[model samples]
Each structure stands twice: as C-alpha cells, then as structure tokens.
Target: MINKIRLAIRNDLEASAETRQFGSGWISGFLALVASIAGLLLLLSQRYPQWFSMKELALIHNQTIFSFVIQSILVIAFLLALINLVLRRNKILGFSAITLVFASLLIGQLIDPQEQYIANAYALGFDWFVLNLLLTGLLFIPLEKLFGRLTDQPLFRSEWREDLFYFLISSVLVQIISFLSLSPSMFILETTGSWSGFRLLVAEQPLVLQVLEIMLLTDFVQYWFHRLFHEIPFLWRFHAVHHSAQKMDWLAGSRMHIVEIVGLRGLTIIPMFVLGFNQQALSIYILLVYLNATFVHANLRFNVEWLKPFIVTPRFHHWHHGIEKEAINVNYSIHFPWLDKLFGTYYMPPHQWPKGYGIGGHPVPNGYWKQFLYPFQKKKKTK
Candidate 1:
C-alpha cells in the first residue's frame, strides 16, 4: 500500500525531455538510478510471485520465508539510501529516485499477487543478478573514468548496445552455458569411469598447490586452443566476432561467439577434471577466470610494469586484439605471457599501445543477432 501511494506521486519524475545535459554527475546519477531499478525489479519478481516461473530460477533452491523477508528489506534499504544520496548531494532526482523505485515495485506487484513464495532450490536468482550488476557498475565505472586508456572515449560508444545485449544474454543463459561447458568433462568421466584413481593424486595436494597447478596447466592446455582459433581458417570466422568489438571496456569481454564460449570453456575445463582439483579449488579458479578475463579486456590504463614479464595484463591482451599486421597473430596465452614468449608468438613493444583494433580488411556486421549468423555466411578473403 505504501509503495502504491509513493509510485502515484512519483509519476511526475518521469517527465520526458527533448534534450538533457550529460556529464560526470549525470553518469553517476544514471548508474545509481538503473542499479536501484534493477535491484527493485529483482525483489518484486519474487515477493509478488508469478513474475518468474519455478523452472527459471537456478541458483538457490528452497528459499526460506525469513530469507525472502530479509532480502526484501535489504533491497528496499538500498533503494532508500540512493534517495538519501540524492538529497545529500542535491542530485537531479532528490527524493524522486526512491519514489520511482516505489512506483516500479507497485506496478510489478499489481501484475501479480503479494503472497510470498519459497522454494528449496531452482529459485530464479534475479537477486544475485542485480547485485552483480550493481557491484560491477560501482567498481568499474570509477576505474574507467580515472584510468581508461581512451580518455576521450564516451561511456556510450559505438557497439555499446551490442555488447550490452551479449552481456545480458550470457547472464540469462548462464545455466545453459554451464551445462554445455561441462559436456567435455562429462564425456571424459563416462569414457574412463574406472580411472578415477588418478584424480586422487591431485586432490591429495594442498588446496593452494592444487590451484597453482591448475592455473599453470590451463595456461599450457588452453594456449593451443587460443592459438588454434586464430590459425584455423574456419574457426577464425567465429572468433572474429569477439575481436569485432572496436571499443574496449569491462563489458567488451562478454561479446563472444556462443560457439566459441561453449567450445573454449568446455575444452579448458578438461585439465581441471583430468587433474582432479577439489571442489573448493575449482570454484576459486572459476571466479578468478571470470574476474581476470574482464579485467584484462577493460579499457582502464593500468600499468603492470614489472609484472609484464610474468602474467597477462590489459596491455598484453589488448595487443593481441590490435589490428597491426605485426601483432596480428601474437600473444595467444591468456594467463602467462611467458608461454607466448617461449613459443615465439609473443609481440610487445617498449611503452607502446595498439593504434587500432579489429580485422584490418574484414568488416563485421553490427548487432548481436547479425554477428551470431555471420560465421555461417561465406565471405570472400577472410583475413
């Protein structure tokens, strides 16, 4: 009831504008507003029920009533705090941000009943989705603004919508992606059901050692996979979609070929399975993989000076994506730059960055759907 009344009063906040000013302040407020709306919609999708079906939820199963109540309180508190920020800073929205949130919640509630729903498992995790979005937005937006390589680049650049679509689609299809990535492991387990004893050696090692070993092994195993995508003519067609992103940012890494994701992830996990790391180590590696992948592709101008000789960084990976003829086939390793150096594929220069990016002559199409269908279409002279 309180939410309904608030939305009614806040409807005026949505005044359409023919034009509006844009600046750091506007960007900050927009981020906060979007995050608030995302968090609220996720909350309502559950509290109201019927918003998400039972089968759609994949993260936590059998959510308790207390858990649901606590979650709702946290989301509401977070939204209220955004209003507090606005008032304290005299932001564009003032208390209107909170009212808009309330309005959204009210409309969402009206679409269904208010009765709470709980489940043991398979509950749609719109909650975690919103949290992840807010956390990444808060963390990376500042990093990019302060240290981004392309200082003059607008936050909203060319292909931004395409990358955003890729990010959202990947998030929504995470479950399917996970299952497909596990296909190789499942196949190996099925074929060699009796050889499970080998994994014990890996499992017996200390957890830290296990993680270290997996890291090195993946760098070695996946190196060839990365290189193969470049050397193989047919495969390069699919991988080109990833490099097609002319602009680089935290979100840029998510623009990947669906086939590339399934194949590459599936192949990379084989080492973990064959070597047999414990569940904890495997989970940590997965988290690190995600963070590192995003970080290396980010637009931030981070200088890892002395560490350049050891591991991959934004400078290292960006070179790989450079359109320069000399760097067209270099820097294939994802984790250790040393692997590239040893194999003779490493390409870097003294305090220099790529002047351009993307395929030199081949122009890829726009939009996520178009790019997805691009590899199948025959194009003359793919280089």
Candidate 2:
C-alpha cells in the first residue's frame, strides 16, 4: 500500500502540467493528498509530543485554534478527494489521500492531549516542519504562479522532490542542527564570562540599532565563508550540491549540504551570541534571515533594480548559481550587495538573468543522500 502511494505520487510528478487541467481533478487531488499528509503529521505530533514536537513551539500549538485547524484540514481533504473521485478516471490520488485521512482519524481517537512524556536525547521536529511548510508554501506558491520569473515552470518542477526532501530533513532535525550550531557560541559566552559588562552595554542599545548591527556583522562573516566555499576545492565538493540546482524557486535554497549548514550557522552566529544581543533582537534577526533567504531564492519577477546597489535580490543571487564562465567566483554577499562591490566580486548585468543554472559539467549527482556522501567520495579523472 505504501509503495502504491509512492508510485502514484511519482507518476503524478512525472506527468506533464499541461495535461492536468482545471476540471480534470489533478489539482484537487494533489491538494487533498497534501492536506491529508499535513493533518496526519500534526496529529502524530500531538499524540507523541515528546518525540515529534519542539518545546519552543508548544505555545503555537497549545491553543484550541490549532485543534480546530486540524479538524478543518481533514474535512477539506476528504471533500476534495471525493470531488477527484467523481471527476477523474484515475482513482489513485483520491483513494490514497482518503486512506491517509482515515488513518489520521483512527489515530486521532487514541490521542491524549493531556498526556506528557519527557523528551529523550533526540526527537523529530514535526511541528516545526508542518508550520514551516504551511507558512512558506502558502505564501510562495500563489505568488510564483502569478508572477514567477519562469511563468511556465510547474510547481513540481524537475528535482523538486529532492529539494523538498532537503526541506524535510532540515526541519525534522532542527533540534540537532540548532544544538550543533549554537554549542560553540554558548561555550564562548561561558568562557568569556568577564566580557559580560561589555556584552551588556551592547545589548542595552536600541533594539532597532542592534538588529542593524547584527545584519552587518553576520553578513560580513558569511561573505568570506561564502567565497571560501567557492575557491576551496574540498569545500566546493559540498557547496556544489547547492549550485547543482538547474532551476531556481523558493524551495531550491533548501538544497544545502548539512556540513555547510552547521558550519555556516556555527561561524556566523558567534557575534550575535557572544556579543550579547538581547533575546528579542536575536529572535527578530533569525526571523529576518529566514524570510530573506526565501525571498532571495524565490522565482519572482519583481523589478528591484533600485535596490540592487544596496541589497541582494533574486537576480543577484541567481548570478551566483549561473553556469556561465564569467559567473564564476562573483557575488558572494548574501544581504549587502555592496560587500561584493567593495571586495571586487560583484557582477550583475543590468536587466538580465542567467542563461542557465547548475554546474558546468553537472559533477554532483542527484538526490539527497547521494549529495550528502558526494563530498567524501573521490572524484574520477577524465583524460
């Protein structure tokens, strides 16, 4: 049954978007599948909070509103699936979605919201995954459809599953990633306890000023690290996985090597952590980073030439992923385009996008696990 569901999705993904007409039931069926899966995942997290829920997200899901949301989603999924079954000759998507919704309903009966268990050494971040997916997908999907740079590009573009998998693992392992990324900063703070007076002074500054300072500091650190990954051969092996994306979309940025993720977070966050930015400032900065990262990588068609000199835009970052010869080793800054201009690495052709994306020869193999092990594998010689 599981294999059947997987095959159904794979088939749908491979199907041409042109064939999936409005009244043909494909859209409703696909949405039904998503709703069912999301509903089930949230229900599982509620049932086994210790293993599937993040402690930080407790407040977000604890309210009665969340319960109402889950119920509404399940109901919507069931109705959509029924509509698909009535309209389409293929029953696969409809049947599969309905089955999952039924499974979620059965498990919902066993859930005890009051029951609590202490979290073990490790737990999945299901709550985080669901929320992240809902928020980003909701915001970007419609915008992309309406104003995408590549207007014809389908939602399930080539290699989308791989990027989505990257999104899944990164979110589900958020706890592990956060701990690994933040431990060094935590240690530095403890060891430099004498610097508390200085840190306190920095933290006492206006919240707006602190956030601006954080943006500059973190961008400066990330700029050099970003260049090093491109220049250093060993590091390029891992970073190449990110560049291997042939298509640019909101989800494409999620295709990063885990090693790079940890290293970047660990190194760039030192100033924010050790310098004692207040918790509120740090939180706001984190939120900004999340939104900015998504925005820069999104497939939007907005004209932002006015802001190009001061800030990074989709066209600016797309050049970094361009496979053209001149595109090599340029545009290393993430937030401030001026950093690249100052360091003489800036290259953005006025009113022009990349001819194509991905590595020149496409050395990096496809899929998540393959790319994960790619950096460790020895490269083959070609005469």
Which candidate leads the pack in TM-score? Answer: 2
Error of 2 at 72 (Å): 1.6
Q: For model 2, what is the alpha-carbon lDDT of residue 325?
A: 85
Report lDDT (CA) for all predictions: 0.71, 0.88
Model 2, range 304-324, lDDT digits (tens) per residue? 678889888989999988889
lDDT of 1 by residue, 1-383 (tens): 77764453233233223122343233334444564566465655555333342334423323566346534644564555464454433344434455556665566557543454444233344554555556666778779889999977666666776887787667655656777898889888789867768777779889899888888988887899888888887788888999888888888888999999999988889888866788999998888887888888889787879999988999999999888888788998888999998999999897898997788775789888889998888854355
Whole-model lDDT, model 2: 0.88
TM-score, every prediction = 0.79, 0.95
Predicted structure 1: lDDT: 0.71
Where is model 2 more than 4 Å wrong at Cα?
Answer: 59-63, 380-383
Q: Which portions of model 1 miss their true places by more than 4 Å? A: 1-25, 44-104, 107-128
